[model samples]
Target: MFGEDSPEFSLRIFGDIGMHGDSKSDHSKANFSFGSLDFVISGSMGERLTFFSESLIEGEHADAIFFDQERAWVAWNEGDSFYLQLGMDNSVISRWNRLYNHGRWLETTITRPFLATFEDQGGVLPMHFQGLEIGGLLAPAAGDLEWVAIIANGRGADIEDRQRVHDDNTSKSFSTSLTFTPSSMEALTFGAAALTDIIPADLNSAVRNGSISEQIYDAYFTWLGEQLEWIGEYAWVIHHDGVSGSNFSHRLIYLQMAMPLDDWTPYTRFDLKVMDQNDPYFVPVDQDLDQWQQLLGVRHELTASSAIKLEIGFGHGQDRDAGGAVSSDDFISAALQISWTF
Candidate 1:
């Protein structure tokens, strides 16, 4: 990220597009596509405040595209100790969601772990919330308390396997995260997160109360070295009445490592996501504790502003509608992507 010193209006135009194919059982699949076109407009109001609006038009299929206002927010700095933001922006719920946005070139892997994509992209969790975030820093250097508190319209109603629009219920959600940097080792930080929201109850059954709540707990560790970076996170979701038939509980975890060697960097990650067999949230598709994938990739920087990445993933999982036996979409996949920005 960069800015002009003039404190006046500034605009930047950038985009990422790529194409790839996968060979499975001697058959090739072509998924040539465009990633995103972004327009960022930013400026400042004198000294203590600044604002930016980022608009994105993204590729969804071979011949289809969609436009979304992913970020349109303002930041007000209350000295070096506190900050406030409002409007449509990143929820900052996790390390990955905070470190990356629509910019694919900033990511080490061509595809995000299945768990981190935005809600519409089949992600199991909501990566965005419309509301406010207040955060602060107690100490400047590592080894202090850095925290965020979120109060937002949790998520919209689940319709056709997707969460859309505003909150389906009148109630909002409250969440928080706290990270402690050990004074002894500034490069390492450990964090804990907790959140709660309401989801529609199963139509087939009813809880003693009308509201069904979902609770989430997460923990993460990070280490940043001279040429290497390591990050690991784990989260669990529990609901008292997720499905019409029963309650739900699910867990997900991922560990990522990257080493930059000059213009060439090699990276790898392990991803796993699963739900208890009786997880009601996955009732639409009978869920099981059997979905996992591992990925390995390498990225080559073509220039200061361009990069090419290649990766392969292999995994297996099954989801059956209603209640059925295991039938799956299991395979090994490969992809090559090119990303650039300016």
Candidate 2:
């Protein structure tokens, strides 16, 4: 730990690395690649305050790496159940979002679900929201509940990557989520979340001028028992582009289960996402994205903070209006990755 003269402040550094290989088709040769490198800093301020930040050196254009911010937040705790935070936040809208990230060592898989991607990664929804969040817990004998409310600049995609910057819209977005954990089944939890925002198609324009109104709905579940853990999530989105006077809808959902055996854990997952074939958002990207994916994998715990994994997955995509040489065929891939934190 690194600290100043005061004992109230301290910091720790950790790193994450990943590598993989893939083949788009059975007859095609596999392509290998370096996944990512991330450095994370987390520390404390006295007893009520703390901060965390992730600085990433991620792969970009072939053999290139660019620096990016995954999360940087300072928080103050009013008590165990109440806290406030301001900064670039991740997974603010969904439970699954909060649970997974670039840290492959922190999760069971190297690849994420289609809906988990950000706007730049071809995701229609916003995963990063620069904003303020107030969250707390409610205690009851029968069950305990957790809730989080968010107010942020929302998300903007027309420009580069500035979703974590200031707002370009006249109005801000509001989101909230609630989770319930029952006493009878302490290992199980269920949650729901919603967000309403207006994303500018032309970020250079004003909010009401040429923006799209978007509303997202989500439901999620988590269960961890003595020998098994399971997760399931579903999200639906509605986009109304008043500028074009057109509406489009999209859906994403997934279910996964993992069980530990001695020092090894095996897992399975299924994911599916669908979008309107004629979505206005597709005009810029050049293709509508829709797919179904399935995965099976196993992880061996080399130590408390390190692991190696082997996974195999398959999927197919359809883009009726696809241009160029885009194929709407099925693909299969396998990967071997190792990750650690220190």
Candidate 3:
């Protein structure tokens, strides 16, 4: 138990060396980088009230570093049956976003699946928001059910705009998810979620002057056994452009599996994204793409608090130009990372 005056704190750091080769380019680039520095604080104010916060420092390059408050929330719990949280939190759209978060050491691979990537990193979905969350767990005759719902300031005019502190519009986003762990097969859990939001118009753009209506539907499952762990998730995104009076749909999916052997673990993952190229909301941000990637990695535990991971990935995608010309992007990459928690 932690006191309010003396909250528990933890720090995690990750660093890596990587080499990437583009099929179109004859030269391969290699660099060493600092991945992230994460700080976490938590404490209990009373028996039912608690507070938690997480901050991250990350580098875009050797000369540039940025700090972000990823999550900060105060919660009131009524045992395991119900809880209410208010503040900034990750959007509960998928299982991966809810499970791993920013804890690099907790994940088996060095990179997150495209489905769970951050918004600033070219992700299509809103990853974080300032919100109110209500959640609870229930035990039924056949299974244990868990549920979560959120209302928040959603996305802004741009894809990278998270609207963390202030909302651009009066319309709030809403999301809900549910998971069930059957009594007979406790190792498996499956869930589904739905989210809706209104994205403000990019007033600076003459072409995209109207708001966008966004809806996302997601489904995911996880199976954990003594030797093998497998996870899969799929999301369908629909957008309606107010100005053009057009509707577009996109799809994103990922599958990951890992095998643990003593101090070593091997993992593999596949990710796919298919988008409608004419979607104004995505076209302006250069996020409309048909892309896929395959990854293989191995992780070795050096100590209880540290691990080393080696990964290789192959990717292919299509790119569209302003004149509606299409191009292909193919790349192969390798990375080695060392991560530790303190």
In terms of TM-score, the best-performing candidate is: 3
Q: Model 1 misses residue 50 by how many Å?
A: 2.3
RMSD, every candidate, angstroms: 4.3, 3.6, 2.6
lDDT of 3: 0.85
Task: Please report, in order, the local distance difference test score of every candidate based on alpha carbons.
Answer: 0.73, 0.75, 0.85
lDDT per residue (tens digit) for residues 1-342 in model 2: 545423353333334444454455333355455666777777776677788888877675456777888889999998869999988777556676787656668777766777676555666567777889999999889899999999988767462445676677777888999999999999999999999988766744443357778899999999988699898889988888777688888888989899989889999999898776555555466335678889999999899888888888888876444353444768677877777776
Better of 1 and 2 by lDDT: 2
lDDT of 3 by residue, 73-156 (tens): 999999999999999988888789888788888888888887888888878888887999999999999999999999999898
- Candidate 1: list runs displaced more than 4 Å: 1-7, 22-28, 140-142, 159-165, 201-211, 242-245, 277-289, 321-325
lDDT of 1 by residue, 242-290 (tens): 3344566788889999998999999999988877775444444333445
Ranking by TM-score: 3, 2, 1
Decoy 2 TM-score against native? 0.89
Clashes of each: 1, 0, 0
Best of the candidates, lDDT: 3
* Cα lDDT, model 1, residue 59: 82
